[model samples]
Target: MIYDGDEVEQELCVDLYWSFRSPYSYLALHHVRALAKAYALRWNVKVVYPLAIRTPDFFKRMDHMWRPYLLIDTQRIAESLGMPFRRPVPDPIVQDPRTLLISLEQPHIHRLTRLGAEAMLRGRALELVDAVGTMLWDGSVDGWNQGDHLARAVAAAGLDLQDMETAIARDPQARDRLIETNEAELRAAGHWGVPTFVFRGEPFFGQDRVELLLWRLRQHGLQARSN
Candidate 1:
């Protein structure tokens, strides 16, 4: 869908997503918000699990090829965007809390998605989601075991993480429903990947494709284009 810069009075909304463990997602997180603001668009963060969990063997094999590409591509993107990119001291997923690991088999996916939903509900979705993304990507904070990292990030977006945690703990069903719905929605979008952007029902997979979506938005004035 193309968004007309001139005609649209209301902000064009697009879904922004990422997997907590995805380095590419981390890279994309750095500039997605600024891009949205520049285009007068509203970003709707939709945290989803990486494709690795869905197809583990394929991901393992792909990782052999992808790791190098991930490092190189992210560095290039960081350079182009003038953003600082460093590999965090401790990997977020590898060093996560055991209790957290037990609570959610994929803690990164589950926690991110739950937080995204909560932020959406509270009307601070974009900001909170962006903060979380920065935490994951910026390389300043070791996201793995920063003690109060999540809480601080949430609070930075003006949310009460303590309350959010209480709610999530009290309502497992809610979190499950949100995750199930997110997965279903993602599948329906024709790309089972994080850092996917959906504009006017058309799915653009990968951070590299954001510019393509922007071009389409400018050209089509918010109308969906079929592949």
Candidate 2:
């Protein structure tokens, strides 16, 4: 491709549609943060509610093999990446322990998505999610939603938990709207999964596709950030 001398270079942007409950989303986040650091790329991070919320019947509709496969796959991927792995003790989404049926009244995930939206509004979505996701997904911490665990994580992300909580308290409807918009865009991009990265309308759906997203960016002449 030839560039005209007077033509301005367009900034490279990637849209990340992520969910807090997905282990793959957590795994992919580590790579996404590294990519942001190494390149002069704009990350449009949108935290969408997990499928458990958006499509309540999704798990019930999935193949029986999927659950076992996901358990095996996520752990192996974490091992391969040398990242600590553990399922959140109290799953973010409420469900029947024995039947694996999701409950209608969810207490945790809604709050998490609201906070994630607030972080996105503050333009520190990646930092917030990285810190919080680590706390929730990594084997290091238990009862992540208890005490100062969340407050410390928010502070680590360079955000104030009280301030964000206040924002949510003021207008939680607005945060849910933001998440809805992300979900719509994710579907419009031809996918419905978390950790999906969209570059110029093309969707790369899955943690394994991050490399392909990078390759596409390179084809568009993505540049390294200057020191």
Candidate 3:
């Protein structure tokens, strides 16, 4: 994982907007990492707050079929991809089940978003999120937000979680502003959802559009790196 003195060539830049609480984002993360590594592309990430918390009005008026269909579709997609799938324990957003109204308390998610920004600063956000989000979404770990789970995941991604937490604590306002900026960029990119990939101002939204992105990348002369 160490980079030598030789400078790496960069070509396309993918502005990836994702959410920690999104199952689709969980599923698409590894692919994004692979896409970046497989070709000469600058894989930039913009982590944002989930729609449930970001837009309360829309969350309240969302189509009734949205949640149920999302659950069903995620399960189906997980099965097709041979990935472990399960509903998160104490879901990321603590909401009233009846009204689906998001709660004001979001200790876990706020920490995640803040640390996600830290990871990005360290140039490892995609890898860190891919590792930790899968644990939460795939049911591999319980109480993902508790104990040393997150720390271990960060370490595995070649970062110190304690250091990241420390840095974030040092400037809460800066991290908050970065997240706000990311949300604004996501909206400006013509998409407000997780897993939206924007390449040179063109937006490809959704986990299923990865192939489409690849096609466009190929059109721009993307090629596999010589081993």
- Superposed by TM-score, candidate 3 places the C-alpha of residue 101 at a distance from the truth, in angstroms, of 1.1
Query: Of the candidates shown, which would achieve the greatest lDDT relative to the real structure?
Result: 2
* lDDT, candidate 2, 35-141, per-residue tens: 98998888888999999889888878998888899999999999999899898867899988666788989888998888999999999998888999888899777
Which of the predicted structures, 1 or 2, would earn the higher TM-score when compared with the native?
2
**Which pairs of residues collide in candidate 1?**
2-217, 2-221, 2-222, 3-217, 17-195
Q: Give the Cα lDDT of each candidate.
A: 0.68, 0.88, 0.82
- For model 2, the local distance difference test gives 0.88
Model 1: what TM-score?
0.79
Order of candidates by TM-score, top first? 2, 3, 1
What TM-score do all the candidates reach, one by one?
Answer: 0.79, 0.95, 0.92
- Residues 1-227, candidate 1: write the lDDT tens digits: 33445665555678776666676777776557657546666777766655555454444355455666877987888888777777654543433333222222455556666776767667787778667767766767864345888788888899988787778778767766766677788888887877788877899988788779878766655433232
- Once fitted onto the true fold, the runs of candidate 2 whose alpha carbons sit more than 4 angstroms away are 1-8
Error of 2 at 65 (Å): 1.2
Candidate order by decreasing lDDT: 2, 3, 1
Q: Any runs in candidate 3 off by more than 4 Å, and if so which? A: 1-10
Q: Mind giving the per-residue lDDT tens digits that candidate 3 earns over 43-117? A: 788788888778867766889988899889989998888788887776888888888878888887788888888
